[model samples]
Target: MALKTYHGSCHCGAIRYEADIDLTQGAGKCNCTYCLKARAWTTFMKPEAFRVIAGEDHAVSYHKHDQAPVKFHCPTCGVHVYGRGDADYMGGPFVSVFVATLDDATPEELAATPVRFSDGLHNNWQNPPAITGYL
Candidate 1:
């Protein structure tokens, strides 16, 4: 697999980060409560492959009850850029970045990226939702 360096930020530019992602490996689309609300189109990578390039002080983490994925967004822009997973089921130590936040990816790059759907809404993350049209 080949890793591509990507740079991204929140809507208002309050938070900036860089990540190394292997888009050919595929991304994820989930129907979880939070992801649904945010319309998250995301890709996962090792935490070591991602870093906050700026505005760390402006970062705000949003935890959903006892969920393992801690979503981090820009406090100023309220844009969810990425999340850190700590649960084994989530493949611990992973960073899930919202592809929409990727500022440097070309339209062609995103269009060509493969995606997998997940049924997070039903707590069945290992499998895709029955109807993926909404997700």
Candidate 2:
């Protein structure tokens, strides 16, 4: 698929951003606790590919269990939008955007693409599984 432009924001529109991504590559939806709870769908992109057009101050971060990755969220509405980490953990030097937050794309647009599931819940680094049947 060709690369497409997308725009998204936090709940209440406090934080807004845009990205150029290839939806055909899809995203990762882990069964991890936080992921399951938030129902986060993620797509990886280089940090430079994503731009925070507004509300940078409203953004807060969380790091757990010594994991170098830092999850960024909107403090006001508590939306887990994306994250950045070491090259290895992120599949390279990139930030993984929560596909759920991309406002320009509809759920159908997301469902139409392929997604690879990483065993983030089990903390398995190698051999990540492909998730199926998730809406």
Candidate 3:
């Protein structure tokens, strides 16, 4: 799919944001503690492609023990929206957006988009299992 801008927000409508995403590239399904609990379908994009349109102050961030990928969520509804990390985790510096927060993304679209499982539980980015599935 071609790159497209997608609008999203937290559960209570706070923390509105937009991101330029290409669903044809697929998403990451990580097995880390946070990812496992949140169960979010994530797609990465450059910071320039992401913008906080409104209610940014209403969003809260949680950092894991490693302080990588600070997870952002809405304080009012406690919904995980997206995350960012300074280091290069998946190719280069990127902002990870949760597809579930996307306002216009359909379930069929999500299912059609591919998924790659990441062994984040062990921090093994080099070679994860080849098992594929959808969120």
- The top-ranked prediction according to lDDT is 1
Ten-residue stretch with the least lDDT total in model 1: 84-93
TM for candidate 1 is: 0.94
Query: What residue runs in model 1 are displaced by over 4 Å at the alpha carbon?
Result: none
> What order do candidates take by lDDT, descending?
1, 3, 2
Q: If both were scored by lDDT, which would come out higher, candidate 1 or candidate 3? A: 1
lDDT of each: 0.89, 0.78, 0.82
**Candidate 1's error at 61, in angstroms?**
0.8
31-135 in candidate 3: lDDT tens per residue? 767887898779888888999999878788899666468889988899899898766556666899998899988788788888878777778755464453432
Q: List the RMSD of every prediction in angstroms.
A: 1.2, 2.4, 2.2
lDDT of 1: 0.89
lDDT of 3: 0.82
| Preferred candidate (lDDT higher): 1 or 2 | 1
Candidate 3: stretches off by over 4 Å: 129-135
- Would you list the clashing residue pairs of candidate 3? none
The alpha-carbon lDDT assigned to residue 14 of candidate 1 equals 84
Candidate 2: where is the Cα deviation over 4 Å?
Answer: 89-91, 126-135
Q: Residue by residue across 16-89, what tens digits does model 2's lDDT show?
A: 88988999887877766667677878887888888989987788988775554678899889888778776575
